[model samples]
Target chain A: IAGITQAPTSQILAAGRRMTLRCTQDMRHNAMYWYRQDLGLGLRLIHYSNTAGTTGKGEVPDGYSVSRANTDDFPLTLASAVPSQTSVYFCASSDSLRGDTEAFFGQGTRLTVV
Target chain B: SQQGEEDPQALSIQEGENATMNCSYKTSINNLQWYRQNSGRGLVHLILIRSNEREKHSGRLRVTLDTSKKSSSLLITASRAADTASYFCATDNFRGGGADGLTFGKGTHLIIQP
Candidate 1:
């Protein structure tokens, strides 16, 4: 069973371009999250969804948007990519929003904006 | 800003040696989780310790939490070349008594020299 899968393993885009990072999970998890990782920094949460229709802003939400159309998918979109937005993005999911539950992660997408 | 801060950014040791990494946070959390990631890959859940719990063990990994000092540590015993990866500590900040997400540290790069 593929726990989670992310599209576009790596991509390079021009500044001001639009891009979307897709994440899908077959686990039917109730909660999903998006995070970005930069050198010398840990993963930073960009957005999260507690359930299919409810979403919340995370620690780092600027320049990013996410939607949970269904239980299996959560997509992160960058309306206009910028050089500063280039980073490794990761998608994670959990059975519930409970803090103690283990979170499963998908292989990250490396995005570069020039 | 990053809530958890890991000490000794990098560590290198012999295959059989023990490796320890510490993480400190600013506020109280519901739980602390440890994750491991190989270069350019998604993170894998290692272990989790709750606020009320002190220590937890999984195989060769031992994790300790001290709420008084607002810190946590992950100890890997009998490390192997396969164990060489970046270790991260994530805290679920439920400080306000509501739903919260994880905040990751800079992570500790553990290199197992064979």
Candidate 2:
């Protein structure tokens, strides 16, 4: 089974354009997260949802928004993409919010905003 | 600034040599986890060490947590060429009845040369 699937493995978006990164997991996880991976900056959390219908801003959520309509889907949207937004986006999920529980990640989405 | 920082941004060693990566964080955490990422791919969880625990092992991986020093280390024994990848340390600050709290380090790129 595909534990997690992310759409549009790679994307090139122009500055000021709107873009959405879609993530879905079949594990029926209770917690999901969106993080951006940048060189020398590590993975910065953009948004997270502990469960369906609840969302919280992460460390770098200024230009991103996320919605969790169901248990399987959590999408990250950039209202206006910018050059600085170019980075690899990863979607991860965990069975629960337990401290010792591990997270499963999907193949990242490589987005380049020019 | 990111909460976690990994030392030796890049590491290279012979295939039979052991590789060690260190991670330091700024705040109290529920647990510290190690993850590996291949080039142009997503991250895979390697191991997790709780704040209350001192050490853990999985296969060839040996992870040590020193909460008093706010640091952790991962050791890979008998490294192989296939062990070449970027390794990251993530800190979870989750507390009961709250949103998930996590942060990641810039990661150490380890290269196991044949």
Candidate 3:
């Protein structure tokens, strides 16, 4: 009950439409991240926030944006959905950005762009 | 860019046997982690081994890290039907600054034949 939660377990969106995937964690973690998992490609980091009010791009940040208004939430937004963006998006968080820390992940949001 | 690459990509083992998956990374890392993802769910942290550490164990899971080789392996003993899932290795790059998120490798899909 006290972990990361992602909304709209699955969604189908048309290309060129705007969509935002919601992610919230109750762990009070300092680092929150968004990743897209595609077949054969694994999970690629899209964006990450180390703390409130600051965010950084990760390996694949194109066409996606994230905002960390506070420590509890990190939402990923796709400005214009593309068929290529159809994949499972995951939200994760860690106590800190330290390499030794383990991350907690939320049930992924399966987004399919038509 | 993907920093880690998991070998085999797919593995199959009989229940009660052991399953081993290997991962190799390109850059120096502060730590390595293993995670398991079920059919259509989020990833769960399995174990974490620091750069200075060689091997770590948690219950039936064993993780080995070799900084010199930039490789790590995950071994699950006494595998069960529930152990059938995709296992991934993630690395935390050793960049002086720690704002970056973990870099994940394409996972190894393991099937446990009961």
Chain B TM-score for all candidates, comma-separated: 0.94, 0.96, 0.96
Which digits, one per residue and each the tens of the lDDT, describe model 2 over residues A22-62? 99999999999999989889899999999999999898999
Misplaced by over 4 Å in model 2 are A97-99, B99-101
TM-score against truth, every candidate: 0.96, 0.97, 0.97
Local accuracy of candidate 2 as per-residue lDDT tens digits, B1-114: 588899989999999999999999999998999999999999999998989999999999999999999999999999999999999999988877654746999999999999
TM-score of 3: 0.97
> Which 10 consecutive positions of candidate 1 chain B have the poorest summed lDDT?
B92-101
RMSD of 1: 1.4
In model 3 chain A, the worst 10-residue window by lDDT is A94-103
Deviation in angstroms for A70 in model 3?
Answer: 1.0
The predicted structure with the larger TM-score, 1 or 2, is: 2
Off by over 4 Å in 1: A97-99, B95-99
Q: Report iRMS values in order.
A: 1.6, 1.5, 1.2
On the 0 to 100 scale, the lDDT of residue B53 in model 2 is 97
lDDT, residue B39, candidate 2? 95
Interface RMSD of 2: 1.5
How accurate locally is residue B55 in candidate 1, as Cα lDDT from 0 to 100? 94
> What clash count goes with each model?
0, 0, 0
